[model samples]
Target: MQKNSQEKDEKLLEKRFAELSRTAFQRDIITYTDFLNLNEQNILHTLPKDTLYTRVVSFGGYELAERQMAAFIPDALYLRWGKSSDPLDYTEYPFSAVRIAPLNRKFAEELTHRDYLGAILNLGIERCKTGDILTDREGAVVFLHRDMAGLVMDELTRVRHTSVKAELLSAGLIDYSPEYEEVRGTVASVRLDTLLALGFSSSRSRLTGLIEGGKVYVNGRLITSNGYQPEEGDVISVRGMGKFRYQETGGKTRKNRISVVLRRYV
Candidate 1:
């Protein structure tokens, strides 16, 4: 009797697992908050570890959640809003959500801003912008929610009117120029320890160690001293950290502190 009961329980568990897997495949949006709640309740513990989760957060939101999730699941991906041309214009807030399929490539391109927003609306999730879209590493696209289908269709209709007006305004702004060009700042001098303070992977000793090991270079020459001072015209290149060019150093601030500009090279 005990053996029969155990076998029956296993079968039921397998059936439930299969159902959840199918649902996840069918859905494009999943919230981190919801995922966390389900895990806490022991609903997702048996779910396959092979599942890949992709998260979208506004610039600030990514900073809040990435560390916690990264510690436990390194494979989890986080996408944040990137910088825009207009400095005063702000991107939408409250990061969006999207799911990724394992075999899919060209992620965000597959879905557009309209399609993603439509999905969010369909889910009955309020307080989200209709212009937001989610893309993956490969630029494949997915809508945030499945419910906003009709809203998306309606939005697509008005594009012609909006695009014409936008083009006219862009044409007018093309000839505008500022009164003066902004001066490019330079890096005056950098302490050997500044790289360590800036969160480089190497320690002061390790940095010097690399320098002495002939792995560190400034410009094209290998630097032997970790304490080698970098001047305004010099470029510092660490083996793994990339290269930084020293620009003009704006003299000390009111607190009598040095200000330096380190230009990063791609």
Candidate 2:
């Protein structure tokens, strides 16, 4: 039964790939991914050359990730496909950042990533039409399709209970830097459970549950094996826990445990 379902899903994914290629070949503008999961990304990578999209398709986010976030996570990725040789062409990419600020400091509610996301989603914009929503102490910055920039700038007046004003930030002036914290830890093994437990400061038992529950993805593939040994440069993402890059091992400790370095997206 599972194999049959897998075959059905693969067929659907193949159709999606064809649709994406057709859209790119027909439309001159760029397009984004429609919330691809880790399995789907692996399928995309392994697709036959003849079945693949011919144009340049670039993937990026505010932060780097192997199993990319569809929209809301810290390492959310935005896929852009266009005819230009330069992927950084702001004109062809047509991405705009909107700075949403609260009216009053004292009465203002502390906005979260979800708060900003929910507000933008409330505007009837599809998730793929937008990118990351970065929130700070004062306000939030939302990256979205340029076509919807005007609508967001005009109609986005309130975020939840907080009255806010949205202003369009110059495309050239927008910064896409990601914040992350370096972590050094020791693990008994390089297994998925060990590294994840060390990186998240959680128990191996807990991480095991997550891995078995299919909430862990590594290098753009859903990894269900807790004993799966991850290689250096592999990005591990735990749903609700955040994403991290597994750097090289720093040699084994006296106790035979491996010392590892990780960069957790903050």
- Best-matching candidate per lDDT: 2
Q: Give candidate 2's total backbone clashes.
A: 0
lDDT of 2 by residue, 1-266 (tens): 99899899898977777676656555543454554555666666667767744442434334452322221101111224233324454223545678899988789988888988898899999876676677788798777777888999999999889999999887666565667798998988889999998889889998899999878888767789988999999889887788888988999989998899998888
For each of the candidates, give the backbone clash count.
18, 0
Question: Which residue window of length 10 is worst by lDDT in model 1?
Answer: 66-75
TM-score of each: 0.28, 0.76
Residue lDDT tens for model 1, 118-138 = 444554555322212333343
The local distance difference test score of each candidate is 0.37, 0.72
Q: Candidate 2, 156: how far from true, in Å?
A: 0.7
Candidate 1 segments whose C-alpha is farther than 4 A from its true place: 1-189, 192-203
How many residue-pair clashes does candidate 1 contain? Answer: 18
